[model samples]
Target: MPLSAGPHVVVLVEGRSDAAAVAVLLRAHGLDGEGRVKVVSMEGVTNVARDLRKSRDEHPDAMVLGLYDVAEERFVLGALRRAGVPLEAPVDLVDHGFFVCDSDLEDELIRAVGTAVVEDALDEMGHLERFRTFQYQPEWRHRSLTDQLHRFAGSGSGRKVALAERLAVRLDATTTPPPLAGLLGRIAQHLHP
Candidate 1:
């Protein structure tokens, strides 16, 4: 469908977890993301090219940004190229508003907030005991705390998004993961400028 007239920003994310994380972080940063910014889950990074094309056609005047795993840089760069966004190299991604999570959004959040903060969020959600149990599982026993937490966050149904939102809620805007924070900053700046 056609976009409504005037300014809007579209934040394309890889999945529900990223979508939930972005929306929560924007609010945490005191932005009404739901107002002029829309967080869309593209389902998979490979589909970025298609979605970019569609968003361009449908919202020709809207600013488009995205968050992707660092591992998916090639796909994002290719998508941008296909969608007619000129880029000299991968480093220009942010100049065009895209941000890269360290490995993935979950990993970024886990590292940004640190072990204790993440544990506290898990505890607040009543999942700390379950997480402890997960760590003791045979395959997870030898993993690092970060690895265990990352995997545990995605292990259960709806758990990934739930954990993402919880982690974002627990984070102060100043301490937000850079990629997520950058996305919010770009959105706010674009909307106001």
Candidate 2:
């Protein structure tokens, strides 16, 4: 679909899951971004530079912010640098309108709500038993619960996006994970301040 027009800020996320999570959180916090803010998932972390450049080229006056996984911080930093957003490190990039997820959005959400709660969420989705079965496999037996959960969430196609949407909907606004909260706050500040 073609992007909406006029003075809208663009929030470049790594994928649809992040986009959905961000969208839900923004609405939860009372920020109506349907037309004023564009949450575009670049499809992958590797596309950060290209996406940023494209957004800038298409919407020169629109403010741009980025959300990425911590593991891809270097790529984000390089993208920001190439886009002329001055920064020396991941933390520095935040002030330049880029936020890094700890490990990834799934990791952040899992940590924010805790594994038990996530399991409860999975149970609600009728996948908790399946997840448990996956967890008991020899290869996953020694992994941390969080790691196992993360892996399970991504193992099936569309699972990550579904979980992200459901989890974001389930999250309490006041207790949102730092990276998400910070990204929303930055978007709010940019749009309202």
Candidate 3:
């Protein structure tokens, strides 16, 4: 079914990588653009308020969920306020407030796809050594490999879909951080409910 024409849960981020990761998480859990969910990024937070104000205008009836690292939350929230979004409104705000550790989503990608695919993807991107170095950090040792990959994929929708397909092969109907089944369930709930 088609999503309604209203403001959806809009997740605004700082870059394509973070956008991709959040998208993957949303898709995996089954939230989408059929009027219930949407994802966007500002590239830079300087005028994010203006951008979200524009989104508010476009989808006035829906909620807006904003996500940016805590480092930039002040600026991002200021921008949104400048754009006329009310500060106390739940319909207009949500942020995880921090960048993923290990430098970027690539770390999570490496964790998810395994060393082989991670290395292959990096080699394909010509950043193999850089990624390898990052992967070896002590902090990364704490997170499960799959969570890392999901974090990378969840940064944006296109990558989310791509990663979801890959994860689908490895997961079953029940899983946290969402498996494909989780995504489908959300879609069904949103579309049918």
Candidate 4:
């Protein structure tokens, strides 16, 4: 598949939750990512590398970005590399990407949504005790409960937005991704200009 001269940045994730977080981030960043950043998530890591490889082959010239957890980063990146993905190239076969966190897209959501709202939301959802457990679990201990709640909320766009809106009700300015605006624009900048 030859690269096309269009504006589309496909974002492959590990699950629907990750897709939702990226979707909201795109909205918050004023990037319309819903359309451009196509979220093709799998049930587990086994199919991630495979799916990415297939997408890359299908869109050889397009900028296909894969975002997932750091735990599987090494494996995914290695898979892409083995599939002839040129990480250093300006517009290579695939834009190999990943994030570091206990949960894949949770950290980003926590960072974006803040703490108080998260705690309240989790309390509303009746997960306060489990949330506290996550807080004391060493790795999750350092991060604020609110942020952890944001990550949990970000499991899906419907859930994430509902949580955001609820939080917004309490405070204000809980900005979210406006579908596929900024992400498409950014991809355009990278591919075109």
lDDT for model 1 comes to: 0.85
Tens-digit lDDT track of model 3 for 1-193: 5555653455565666656556665665556545466667777666577767777788775445454444555676577567655677453233322222233334434444565664455465445565455456677656765544444444444654454334333333433222223334433454557
Ranking by lDDT: 1, 2, 4, 3
Tell me the tens digit of each residue's lDDT in model 2 across 1-193: 3434664688999999899889888888777545777789999989989999998998887889888888898898788778776564325777788888888999999988888888988888889989989999999999999999999998888888888988898788666888888888887876677
Candidate 2 TM-score, C-alpha based:
0.91
Q: Give the clash count for model 1.
A: 0
* lDDT by residue for model 4 (92-127), tens: 222334333344444444444567556767688666
Best candidate per TM-score, number? 1
RMSD of 1: 2.8
Q: Model 1: residues >4 Å from true position, as ranges?
A: 1-7
Off by over 4 Å in 3: 1-7, 33-35, 83-193
User: Number of backbone collisions per candidate, in order?
Assistant: 0, 0, 21, 17
* C-alpha RMSD by candidate, in order: 2.8, 3.4, 7.7, 6.8
Compute each candidate's TM-score over C-alphas: 0.91, 0.91, 0.50, 0.57
